[model samples]
Target: MTDQPQVSAEKPSEASADQAAPTPEAEAIAAYLLKHPEFFVEHEELLTTLRIPHQRGDTVSLVERQLKLLRDRNIEMRHRLSQLMDVARDNDRLFDKTRRLMLALIDASSLEEVVIAVEDSLRQEFQVPFVSLILFSEKPLPVGRWVSTEDAQKAIGGLISDEKIVCGVLREHELAFLYGAEQGEHVGSSAVVALTHQGLHGVLAIGSRDPQYYKSSVGTLFLSYIAEVLGRVLPRFTQSSRPVY
Candidate 1:
């Protein structure tokens, strides 16, 4: 055992230790700064001293970076606010149009007047390009496009099967039936709602040239409401004529 003396393992150098891990003092300072966000306000000189690396590989003072961050946030907020204002203005216009349409529908005396009111309001007031209102009847009516119940079922039975509103790109045949052959070819999307009160009165469908316009039911509330109103009102006029089921 006395032939060889034991040698202790060499300890890591100070430079290696420093490079391996941050000192506790630096970590404590960081933690304290986080806990006291107003620390910079008290020590204004530190703001000029602290630097943040920029995307361009240049360093910017903490104050400049903070100002940039604040400016970016302000711009984003302004953009969001502008969008909200636009939506509000659009809703106001929609409300006014809807009010006018309701009045016209209420004032209508005859079936022809009713048909005229809806078509005119939709085309002129609502600015809808393509509008269709088909009434189902066994016999030809004096006003509006009248399709026999059997024919209506044959053409668009799936659309009028329920009271819920339907929206999206329709098949070529459906588009033709709702908007007509030539006009339907130009229509990219459509929204349809069945008029049902005591019975299935008819179908109300609107079309847009933009394919994405009526892709969903997001903006079809007014269409559905108008259809509901027509359903209830049409029954009053059709009682004598007897609109088929």
Candidate 2:
């Protein structure tokens, strides 16, 4: 048979030399993810792409190492989130508990009850182990002295002693809070705040086991609140506690 004349066909235009070409490795990586985005993303893909045989122990070792690192980071993130959740829950409980107890403290019927309430509240609020409350009065007569401290009744029965600590308080409202002042028998580092209204006046003492618990420039909102409650409650106690003439 006679050979037919070859038909000439125009060649398609080629891309400019300056144009960049996508590498086969990049295309392979994209296809691997597109086919199995989740299951193939981790260490196993490293071996699969490299076409490492099952007999190659070195490839398996490297894959295990990378997987362990990812697992550790995931565990650390979960642990940190758990700790933050616990802290949020604890703070919520504390604010609610403190607000309730403080309200109960304000309703105390007597000075002793007030002190007990204050001590309990402080222990719960601030996490202190121990607490005490003292009231100082220049009532023209020593009040809350023998009555509060029965053991000191015999010693104080002799009117007044030169060694008594009352001299410092009535020395004037000069000292607001005494942290660790030497006060003979009543000797604990205490938060001494004043409470006064017209004719009836006194200082309130709040003490704890730790010496550093109370400081000089500490804000007195809670202390002042207790003092105000005491002013209201003391009147009722005084009328009921007065000796029959």
Candidate 3:
């Protein structure tokens, strides 16, 4: 008879059992905290023990951290509100100036008078350093800085797109065409507003000696509005007769 040896099962050691047990991961803990908002109320002592790092290299309690975040948000909101208020004030002033200019244009009976009114108001009221108006029509207008449509196109056709307002430093050729060579040399930046109504096409050019006076990023709402007003009013002055260039 052959005798078979008996097999015995041994229990796992305490150290091995402890090592095999699953530990809670940081992500799982975070998820649990998010899912159970009331967990903080149950264990409020953790709020005093937990520390968060601040930009100033100081650690703060959870309550203090929350207060800091609220303060930062409040400051940001206040700054944004101040900027909005400033913009509103500026818009109000511009509206008043535009109203006065509109009245002046309406009162002028002749094209020459309208031109004078625009130039004077732009200089005195709007504080524009340099201004020029170029009308494109066959009808003869009072002799001034008026140039033929062909001349104007050759000078600034590429700059203007439909009725869009162009703002930035103008090219040497464009600058010279809008302003005289002597005046152009002094202008560092400019805004050119295109005007079109019926069969009339023209441009109102404003120049400044300061390079930053007119920025490309600046809004052209007021300039476009003025151009629209001019387009409507200036056409009334032009006659059917061909203008002698």
Q: Model 3, stretches more than 4 Å misplaced?
A: 1-59, 137-140, 212-217, 240-245
Model 2 C-alpha lDDT per residue in residues 1-245, reported as the tens digit of each score: 99999999976556655557779998997787789755544654354335322344644453564556667777999999999999788767666655665577567655566556666677777564433343433232233331222222232322122211221122111122232234323433444443333323333454544445455535434455555655556555444232211
Clashes of each: 0, 0, 4
Candidate 3 colliding pairs: 138-242, 138-243, 139-243, 140-243
**Of candidates 3 and 1, the better by lDDT:** 1
What's the lDDT for all of these models?
Answer: 0.84, 0.47, 0.76
Cα deviation of 80, candidate 1, in Å: 0.6
Full ranking by TM-score: 1, 3, 2
- Model 3: residue 114 alpha-carbon error in angstroms: 1.0
Candidate 3's TM-score reads 0.69
Show where candidate 1 strays beyond 4 Å. 1-59, 240-245
Report the error of model 2 at residue 68, Å: 2.5
> Worst 10-residue stretch by lDDT in candidate 3?
236-245
Model 2 spans with C-alpha error above 4 angstroms: 1-56, 59-65, 124-127, 132-245
**What's model 3's lDDT at 242?**
30
Q: Which prediction has the highest lDDT against the true structure?
A: 1
